[model samples]
Target: MERDPPLVLDIDGTLTRPEGWGIDPRLFDPLLEWEAPVVIATGKAFPYPVALCHFAGIPELVVAENGGAVYTGDDVFFTADRDAAEAVAREYEAAGYSLGWGPEDTVNRWRETEIAVQHDQPVEPLREIADGYGLEVVDTGYAYHVKDPAPNKGDGVRTIAEHTNLDLEEAVAVGDSENDVSTFEVVGRSFAVGNADDAARGAADEVLEDVHADATLGVIERVRSA
Candidate 1:
């Protein structure tokens, strides 16, 4: 029997390419038509994906700030479970580490725009942050993303499951970056887009290939079949 539908998705290369920060209708509108909850999961801040969700017409939930915050209807939830992150932040900053988010341990957030304490930083330091934190780092050739562990997309999936009462294993998660690897922990079907990072491709349940280079469509078709 088919399981419950996917309730979460990762942004950036998963749905939209770094060059195209906006929603790509050719890929995601169909997924939106599936009538399933599409929670935005990314290292970006709360309002970051809010605009994307608005653009995509996704009226579900969002796990933002790389699992640091969540947005649901009228309220915004920020987690204190960031202790590990806090530790990483202090050490990273003191080490003079460069972060995707900022000069220090800050997050550069945006949705059709950018916001941050200090948005510009060198890439080498960002990589160092990723290496030091055991996390994934995505640099869109413009922005920086310090993603959580192999449970990033997983945590986002679990968050969606919490409110929907859906079985964790039945959910699906998709992405095209090392950050997406974390999502594999929570879903039965974890997919990597054709353009996904090596770690993501290595860890996914399947890799969307052939003419289905479009990862969003890959996800939509999978749901339709389910």
Candidate 2:
């Protein structure tokens, strides 16, 4: 018998608009009814994704902080050097960057394995500073994520597949920004929503015409056919 691969989704421009403030209500039932494991992977902090999953009434696992960590219900799999991240954050602050933490926690406590900062501030200089410490900086929508690049969204999805006993090659990944590029590289079926950034669209196997949740639904329909 053929088994269904997990559905890995990216939030922000993929699930909701910058103005929507939440996952599209239209997706709730489809998500709750899906048989395969559903995973919400985002550059957002742990608490927000955790709360969103809870509200959606789905058993989807969450890979937060651009794959710097994985959260399954209350259990967490964090894999970053906090000491290194803190040092870098301090350096950026010293260089005159005003940083804002993610929605639920302070910059220092946003994620166990990564530092999340508001993207409205400068990041190129921060990236230069981060490189000296062997860390990579990624811009995920409205936030900048500083973490070990090895464990990215792709790795997060891979971990979820292993945890759920699904085949990596059968999985579907959808997103709309540079941060999702890593995920596009690793998933079998990779899609970039119409609103995706240029880099994200370039990295995807297919770019959907519809935007946001509509694009996500398009991916699901295509996957259902595959």
lDDT of 1: 0.60
In candidate 2, where is summed lDDT lowest over 10 consecutive residues? 101-110
lDDT of 2 by residue, 114-137 (tens): 776777888898899889999998
Q: Model 1, 1-226: lDDT tens per residue?
A: 5543755677766666435455566755665575556667775666767877777676747777556566655455555244444445456667774444433433442321112222376556555655776655555323564545443445655666676655666667777666567776667777777777678789988888721226666566767645
lDDT of candidate 2 vs native?
Answer: 0.79
Of candidate 1, the 10-residue stretch with the lowest lDDT total is 109-118
| Each prediction's whole-model lDDT (CA) | 0.60, 0.79
TM-score of each: 0.68, 0.87
lDDT of 2 at 68: 74
